[model samples]
Target: MNRIPYANAVGAIMYTMTCTRPDVAYALGVTSRYQADPGEEHWKVVKTILKYLRRTKDQFLIYGDSDLKIEGYTDASFASDKDDSKSISGYVFTLNGGAVSSKSSKQATVADSVTEAEYIAASEAAKEAVWMKKFISELSVVPSIEESVPLLCDNTGAIAQAKEARSHQKSKHGLRRYHLIRALLNVETSEFKRLMERKMQQIHSLKHLVSKSLHETLDLGNINSIPNTDDYLWTHGAISDETLSLERTVCNDSTYMRLTVRGRRSQGCDYVFSRVSDEIGADVEHDDLLLPKCLSSSSAQFRPLGLHGKIHAAIARRANIGDPCLPERIFTYLNRPDVQKALHANTTHLPYLWHSCSGPLQYQQDNLDLNIIPLVLDILKEGIPILLFSGDQDSLIPLTQTRTIANILAKDAKLLTMDKYGPWYDGKQVGGWSQSFGEERDGKNVTSLTYATVRGAAHEVPFSSPSQALTLFLSFLKGSALPRPHA
Candidate 1:
């Protein structure tokens, strides 16, 4: 009777057979042998199998794009079954090649020696190999099987027996039966030679062909054939509409109009210039007037401000127009108490500020800062390459922290330090460092960290050096190598 539970178990066995559990093929086959006969023990064993599947559910075989080369393995456990006194035979076959076929089952007959049992397994595997060769040939588009498929047997004796036909005695009945493989091998030698020649031809042909498909058979035409004109129209049309709406909104907004009027009024004001001059004059006098009598005791009772005033007045007369109103606005903005408070508030939230102040709340916040280490680790596990770049002059996240993070992420990663070059140059030598990690181990993961000190650059490196900033940003997006600044 075919039960739903039995059907589910069979479905699971087929799923595993298709995926990475070629090792379990023999076990599934053995258990399925007892499938027709109902038993409580069999159900218990199936449940255990399901539990094993659950534990290894995430693991899967990774098939890379490469030439299909037939490889195989054969193994047998000595007297594994207590009831039959027979060894379990198992073999796996791979092609391009990943494990494409496998089987595991108790031997049909009991073997006297471990060597005998392994020879039997090898024979079984060879039979499958013959069938596989025929199946591959039948496919219309399959690549030619030009090379001698390697049959890997861990037992040295089995390998010797397979290679040496004279080693088997005529009295050895099981060994005699399996000697058919040696006969088949003799017949297939010419075919194997032809396969080798075909492989070389394929390799040479692939070298000149740039259009060869790469990685899991990507639908390149499906993606590339999508008209670029459609994308351009969709993106540019939306952007144009948004731009028009933004302009209309800005022109109609009362606040924007008021700001524009205020900006013009301030720029046109002669009184603003006069006020700045008066303020500068007052500042000079106040400093001179506040000077301690003891420090000025040795000098004459001459007013320094009065002398400076004459010099400034001469300069003002020469110019005829007072200082710009922009300077007065800048001073007014800087002196505003609300602006000063906001600046202080923003600065206080910085990690360095927290460290200096020893603020518990800020320290906790810094501890919980979004470190990219976990994300990098996850990406590496999924076999995705990651690149990290940082500037030495970056006070926010220093080069030291970046290096520490990279080292913690993966040791196999390639780390590179590059000198700043190209547009990032400021007439002086400046460059950045980079670190990378992955299977390619190529310079692709190489990240360049560059730093520049403007003749008088402060914390905001980009703001101080816009040209260098633009060069760095362009290099990052385009994956272009930065030109090195000469020392």
Candidate 2:
């Protein structure tokens, strides 16, 4: 084969490999190596790639219409080239759900072991990640924020090296440029208020203002837990110290009854009205949760004030315990057509039943690793803030557990305590206790991460302590500290 034709074919394939077909990158890399000497083997490999591309000609890269976010994966084949004894580094970056950038090439230097090869690959990927982050930040269509681009590697050693500041003798031979990742990320700040505004925005995106906020807010439990009453069993434990303290100064049945009735009624009305409105608008838009929303909304009305109220009272009277079967009854009642019509619900005629939760609610135990350390680091590297809050009265996932998690995250992220854990006020009363994390000095504060517990709240913070929850929510949205009492 003529050298010119081989080089031309390789160049064309290289263009496609660099742009869209990342799957062919390794093959292109191998084939391009012998461009100086045209051989039957090199030509055979080139022809194979062309054949593969022809067979899969209909395939094209699909970048979906989703939010702009970058994530990357990197790997390496150790000393794969027998001729040169060099490893192959491969990396591909995704924007939302589709690939936007990729590379596959032989290492510039030979690596002695698999670990080193993988580390080099991850370093290369991190460089690309940083570049992509900068590019995405510049785009008018995307948010102008430095969000950490996650560079994933299965090699533990590479992750360790990326996080470590000090150089080890073993990795001394590794190029200094590859250590840029470590320099790019550091979460330390002396005071809560010293965190950069960009960091605050990142935190804001994590919780309240981003597209994934709704999904994050609604994940109530995993497969290990069941629904409704069973999940709230912890609330019935010996009243918490927080609840006991409130009992002396705030116990009043009339006040309690009035609040419960009002809250439930307001929630019920919203639920039903929303369902009715959703039904009316079903022709224009569709959602999987519409039927479930209608059922839950209708069920709320019956909980403390409607048909099931009597049944609950009777059950409480007979068993000398709170009603647990209300959900079962409510589910049955909402399935009735008359009840659906009364609520102006499910006009779309959904194929599924109107249950509060959908099936496959079960999650594997193996999937329950809820560690957020890496995730926190990823967002913090992007200059985002993180806020964690708990309802004071929630026993199931109590304040202690939440507080501990926040403290560990802060320590791991190297965040300084902006404010020691202390009471925050809502209307001259202690609404909750909170702690702030950031960089602070000379009384100037730049807060990054904040954690709070809503006083007198249940597992469902808003439902149990609406006023306090609102206060916390608003403060978070404003990226401000929870209010302090006048000294």
Candidate 3:
């Protein structure tokens, strides 16, 4: 065994185990048993496993924040070993939205029947599940685990054996002293259900459905694609010669008062205009001169008229002698109350509140964009629909652990019973259950929780089963009824 480069082989397998090979846990465990022995066949098997890993290298796991729901799978292979005849057991846990922990190992003792072996395996899986439930409660992340967390087992016989104490007499191997699953169940530690293998197929279908839905809902396929610029013409079209000219004029004015009609519109181009109207009123020939004397003596009282008197004098001095082009409407419009009000409103000093909270605004603008995690958590607490998914075939983190962690976090989560939609291959019906929280409580937000397994898929659900997975995911996200499988 040492001559076969066992360390290197084990390291490669370990890497896969940690990354994407939850399905290989049992295989890896069995292979490790032969690590101490010298055998060419072991090397061949290990090499084959290595080739499998190389083929699936791109299978990474993705964990996201989603609706808090707890569900998982527990599986074991009985009497698989030729040398020791020991069974291999595996379990996975998920939470908040990803796999957290999982294990695959050989059973400690030999068993007589497949059911007995599976019972032992489920017991071990249950212990881990209980520990995870307790751990999540301590973190204050999951609500509570007082209620049962559904653990799905494919072996109906094993499930029955585990649930009933009377069936143990049929076993040759005495039950392990630590087989406390029944006691735990009596006290409501966790719950176990016998799931048909066909249900796993449904879960697998649902997984694909959800993954497709996520892709469609989030449009992840095109997220990194180059954006089309064809429709951006309007945005670019805003830059025009007229706009440029106006911007230049505004920029050049110091006080901006030079833009007024009374000021010189252009340098050295004396196209000056003024209005002179002879109004019938009580007046003498020296009225203009006496007006200034009266205005000066009573400047405070006649301030409003004083400015008008000076304007009238300036107009009398500058009026073009015979320019018929000068329009009287210009002066009349300039003096209109609406025009004055418009100018006052356009002045920059008006209430404009954007500047008032500039400091806090900048701080939030820069930091708030990256801080959506807390917001997501807040929304989850409010009971909004959130779904986190992981492929069991995923390498980054095992979906087994993700399921375990989810159960721990959402221990009190209500369970939706599995219902048969229709039959798949061999007349086996396909269906699964979902649960929700915060939907009915007063002032609580609504969140629907679901977990679906993908059959024979490594990590990518949609890639494995596009049509079924897409349909399920769309229905879940849209809050529409999940499509029934064809009978």
lDDT of 2 by residue, 1-487 (tens): 6634899999999898666566666567667789999798778778778776654443343333345656676778899889999997887666655577777678887887787787777777777766776666677565523545655667667667666755555455564656555665453100011222321111012112112222142221221111222112224433344433332223212223233433322332233334433433432111111111112344353223232322221222212233434445666889888899889987878877775434566434344424445677678656677888876544445565566667766776788988888999888889989999986547877788898987755555564456787888898889888999767
TM-scores of the models, in the order given: 0.36, 0.37, 0.36
**Whole-model lDDT, model 1:** 0.46
Please, what is the whole-model Cα lDDT of each candidate in the order they appear? 0.46, 0.57, 0.46
lDDT per residue for candidate 1 within 17-116, as digits (tens), equals 6666654454455467676674777776666566555544423333333445676667787887899898878776666444677676678878777887
lDDT measured at residue 484 in model 1 versus the true structure, 0 to 100: 49
Candidate 3: TM-score?
Answer: 0.36
Name the best candidate (by lDDT): 2
Q: Compared with the true structure, what per-residue lDDT tens digits does model 3 show for residues 171-253?
A: 44545543477787777777887675434411112223212322232211121111111111112232244433332322222
In model 2, what lDDT does residue 475 have?
Answer: 88
- Put the candidates in lDDT order, highest first: 2, 3, 1
